[model samples]
Target: MPEEMKTLVVTGLRTQFNTAKGPVAAVRDVNLKVARGEIVGLVGESGSGKSVTGLSIMGLIDAPGEITAGAILLNGEDLRKASPKRLRELRGDRIAMIFQDPMMTLNPVLRIDTQMIEAIRVHDHKVGRQEARERCRDALGLVGIPSPEERLEAYPHEFSGGMRQRVAIAIAMLNRPDIIIADEPTTALDVTIQSQILAQMQKLCRDTGTALIWITHDLTVVAGLTDRVYVMYAGDVVEEAPVEDLLDRPIHPYTDGLIRSIPSHNAPGQPLNQIPGITPALDRMPAGCRFHPRCPRRTDACLEEIALRSFGPAREARCIHPLVEG
Candidate 1:
């Protein structure tokens, strides 16, 4: 895709947290791009730095956790160099984030309408209160909320967990942002609710031409939802390809393990397949390839530092001995 088509682009991103020992990197050398109306999956196991990457792009990393190095471009705007005031102004207006917990987006005391309307008008003061309320209603309706006008009057607590998440999605869409980074937004919902939300998100993106970066550990979700996938291990993105290509022929050992671990891939009554070892702690991360310790394909060659190697267009794996050929 051309540069103009990309709504968000992140390059050489390194986010670190100041720990008791020293500064430990949570996200390292991450590069991602999401074009208009595209859904890209950032997939990995827990503690893989997916959330930190999302936070870094949104300029939400606070004290003790700073973006040490990166160029976060939103429609060509350099977010890393942007001032705090500019970031605040851009957050909800041009880019938004849907967190796993709806509470992160909602205020307990406020009614849904109040929150959603405020979310809109805060970015666009020129919009009338009535217009904002109408937009909120439409946004709620867009996300499949029933009786949106009446539902808007209810507090966050009045809605069920799924409903609250829907409201959160509604709020994120209020301003029709160019990009929305969803950090496991449906992880807490039931399987059925999760599917529903995923479908809704797809339709919303298609309708509004809004790009989305869905940060999740679920390969199942990625198979069904994303156009392309980036597989992360520890803090590094080990693989990147179109969703089908990655799932069908993963290059990195870690990416292959993740795909095999999906329940549907195993026969009935068989032991659930899983990656051999636990993710390394940030401070205690292994030298060279972070996943070498647990990798079935590990060799002495893996002990040496390896960088992401390109196979073909949009295909990359950070491994010396990849599982498949170009």
Candidate 2:
């Protein structure tokens, strides 16, 4: 793919926050790229900085949390240097984010239609209210909402949790943004609902050629949904490859441990293969590789900082002695 065709590219991205203890590295230097019509998954456990990386790309990190270094290029535009006003202009129109909580995007007291039309008008004032309403209704139906016209007339509280999330997703798709960073949007839904939403999202990306970044800790979700997966540990991308490659032949020890730890990998009577030790706290990340303390395959070389290097064609890992040697 040509450079100009890339939808999103993040290089040396680092995010940190100020706390009473000290500056905590929430997201260490990381890099990835997504092309038009591609689906990428940022897979990691909680506090592994999956969401923070998404927020950094969206320019949503606030207050003490800031992007200390790196470049976030959306469609070849450097967002790191974009003005606040320019960022606002790009938001919702060229780039949109679907938050984990639906309420964060929806107003409690406002009617759904009121909010949806307002969202459209914010970027396109020339769109008449009635025209915008039709677009909103179309978007809601696209997400499988029943009687979208009537649903639009009701308040957010009137909808169930699954339905509310669907609405949130519809809002993200309203403008057909170039890229969407979904922060575990389906994590709250039941498996059935999650599958349906995932299918819809996949179809949306295909039909519109819009790139997508699905951030979640659930390997199961990434297994079937994503084309490529990036496994993060201690705020850094420890492994990245095609989804099947990462799952069937994980290069990094942490990635191998995560795949082995999945419930489906265990037999009925067998105990799960959980990775030992908790993820190190941000403020107390171990020297060298952040995951070295918890890594079962640790070696003397692992105690020093390592950079992501090629493990094979189209695959990379941060460990000095990765399981899948070249």
Worst 10 residues of 2 by lDDT: 1-10
- Candidate 1: residue 193 lDDT (0-100): 93
Residues 104-196 of candidate 2: C-alpha lDDT, one tens digit per residue: 999998999999998899999999999999999999999999999899999999999999999999999998999999999988889899999
TM-score of 1: 0.98
Query: How does each model score on lDDT?
Result: 0.91, 0.91
Error of 2 at 232 (Å): 0.7
